[model samples]
Target: MRGKRTTTGAAVMIGALAVTGLTFAPTAAAVTPTTATINASCGLFGGGAATLTATQNGTSATITLSSTAIKTPLALAADSITSKLTMVKASGGTTVFSGKKNPAMAAQSPVTVGPLSGTVASGDSLEFYGGSLQMTIFGISVTCTASAKQSPGPFVFD
Candidate 1:
């Protein structure tokens, strides 16, 4: 009985010591986050003032313009012209604003696109514009402006 008590006490002491050692042991430190993704579509806001028209089927986006500051230089093909555009990331990224002008006509006003001209944050997107495109039937100059936002959500289409 005496021998058994001593063995039992030693076992208890060993367990206590093991627990104490584990408590003091060190392994690694803390980690941080760097990247994030937002999932949404029909961007909430900040598409900008320049107008836009788009039809999406996969990665290809087709857009047209009806107004611009300079109305003389190039005649945009009714359907013969196209440009690349990206969804404006509300986090402060790049966006595209396309429009047409035939200043040679001498009595026209530039069309205003929307989401309306306003301030945008990171990661919001939207587009505007529609209808058959027209021109003076000759090559004329066309100027385009664009807007975009970053640090926000993803395209609802994807």
Candidate 2:
């Protein structure tokens, strides 16, 4: 009976050590991209509304702007539009990543931004600014421009 008790205690200690070792074992660091989709209303004069999808991997990011219709009082014929998207640091208001896209009417497309010189850390803000649309309506060409408000975000990067 004594011999059996000693053997059982030894086995229990070994099992405990194995579990402890596993708990402290080093794990391979994984680099996974974080993605966020943000939507904002630009009002009638600005462009109605817009949706932006941003993906961040390390220091690089890709931004996609879904085609949003512009609303104006004018009877428009054709439009040439471009929008610039930026990731700004919330603390300092520094733009970390910037990219532009000239989207077709009612189309969704991805615009790859950059291997950003500045890091887009946690707790950053994003803005869609410098938007211009050139429209040829009623045989006259007109250019309309507007800037979207800065969206508060933590455009996460893993």
Candidate 3:
């Protein structure tokens, strides 16, 4: 009889722990329009359509830019290009994400940068138009600006 009671109590405790774990589990974050596009022009270097991908976790976020239209004129070693990307806020003002993060690229390879980290708030709308992307490669600074607002609208974070 005592053994039966002990077994039942342990089983109940295990069930309670399972329920507690489910109650405290983290939830998946939601960010509207995970992808955005812009027509960027980097004078003298190159430019065209570029894709920007965004992800959010709480107040921390990341943005990655990739473009087949913009290619490196020369080979670039991994994490060698210094890049700073500015973004406009719909409510006014701007935010910047700068880093020297990239993969090695051969001459004429597509340009890709980031996983650039930034801080964002819920309901914040970020667009690239009024902002700019500056990349310094081998001492040459190339500035790229969005010709217009990003398509599919700005990224709305939650």
Candidate 4:
């Protein structure tokens, strides 16, 4: 009876470890191509080429946008840009990621914001062309939209 109990305990321990390993393995794979490009238009604030970078760990993900083409109208303080990124899912509907993440910048400096957080799923394809990026700075609101489809196609998450 003692020998049987020892064997059972060992089997349970191995099973638990296997489960834990499996749960964590996919998180390391990350989303592919990590970076995408878009030609954005922001009206009076001006528009230009922008880079969107992404990272994923399991269902959690983040995206950051930076554009030398778009310049800040004034110097900004860190975490002062109230921004929301809306993306169209290939399957339909939209997902929005909003955050206040920015580095302090001098007047007319390139605009950049976020490592904004959102939830994503395996096989999810998202694009910015049909959506918009809206940002609020110093009581003034600026909106940017992609002029065409993002390069290298839509972001396909793993």
Candidate 5:
């Protein structure tokens, strides 16, 4: 009878643990992130490419733009240039996420933008626009604006 009671107690404990395990299990709403690559160019006289990556978690997103190398006709310094990254809906042309500040071009470091709130689904467009850089080269101020856009393409969500 003692063995039977021990077996019953063990079984009850196992049942309790099983129930507790279910409570701690991950639910369906767990974080699942999606990512996309961005490669675009902008500017006229001295055009530069903006290479960036975008990651989306639910309705929040983050964009990281890597510093780009520029080729221009004038003697320019990286500090004089500023770049901005944006994401927009392809169908309705609504701006979803825009970078808050324009970082200098010569930073040579990755610039991160967001946790911007938006529904970033498949087929959204990415844009990179740089404000014209102005600097006094030999007592003359030079300015140039550059912008690039990526077309909506196939994207998969897991």
Candidate 6:
């Protein structure tokens, strides 16, 4: 009986150690580029010297705009980053197209805001693609001023 109890205790301790090793061991965290898809069903606007707002999946986003003399002599307020989205007449400005995640957009063409079959202009897309994330945000804030030379400005999402 005493020998059996000793064997059982040893087995239980080994089992516990094995279980702890598997459960509590630190894992090697690897950063991989996850190709996740999102449904961009919100419309973004280039408010002439105003802030643009986008909302989807109960999340909201706001991007600041700053003009830089429009580069091609276009009448822009002048700000940091690429204010020249499109060379259009600035009549319609820019807008976001609603579409599903399609890899073809990244490979085939000049990566517009959304899908191709839509009214959104090629230049009229969110500023996120310019090395920032308009998505993956829950809240946003935008500020606009009339006397200010710079139109909209940098955006911060939480």
Top-scoring candidate (lDDT): 3
Per-residue error at 76 for model 2, in Å? Answer: 14
Q: How would you encode candidate 5's per-residue C-alpha lDDT over 37-110 as one tens digit per residue?
A: 33433233333453444565665555544434433344334343333333444455544444333333222333
Q: lDDT by residue for model 4 over 34-137, one digit each (tens)? A: 89999999875689999999988888889999999988878889999999999999999988878999999898999889988889989889999999999988
Question: Candidate 4: misplaced stretches above 4 Å?
Answer: 1-28
Best by TM-score: 3
* Model 5 segments more than 4 A misplaced: 1-39, 70-84, 101-158
- Number of backbone collisions per candidate: 33, 0, 0, 0, 4, 6
Give per-residue CA lDDT, model 2, range 34-120, as digits (tens).
333334433333444444456655555555544335344433222333333445444555453333333333222222222223345
Q: lDDT (CA) for every model shown?
A: 0.33, 0.43, 0.91, 0.90, 0.42, 0.28
* lDDT (C-alpha) at residue 155 in model 2: 48
TM-score of each: 0.26, 0.38, 0.84, 0.81, 0.40, 0.24
Q: Candidate 1's residue-wise lDDT over 1-158, tens digit each?
A: 99999999999999999999999999431111111122112121112233333333343333433334423223333332222233444344544433332122333334322211123232234321111122223333222323232223233222
Model 2 spans > 4 angstroms off? 1-46, 71-83, 96-119, 122-154
Alpha carbon lDDT of residue 11, candidate 1?
Answer: 100
lDDT of 3 by residue, 1-158 (tens): 99999999999999999999999999765677999999999875599999999998898888899999989989999999899989999999998888899999999999999988889988899999989989999899999999899999999999
Residue 108, candidate 4: how far off, in angstroms? 0.4
Model 2 poorest 10 in a row by lDDT: 106-115
Model 6: colliding residue pairs: 64-153, 65-152, 65-153, 67-78, 67-79, 68-78
Q: Which ten residues in a row have the lowest lDDT in candidate 4?
A: 24-33
Q: Which segments of candidate 3 are over 4 A away from where they belong?
A: 1-28
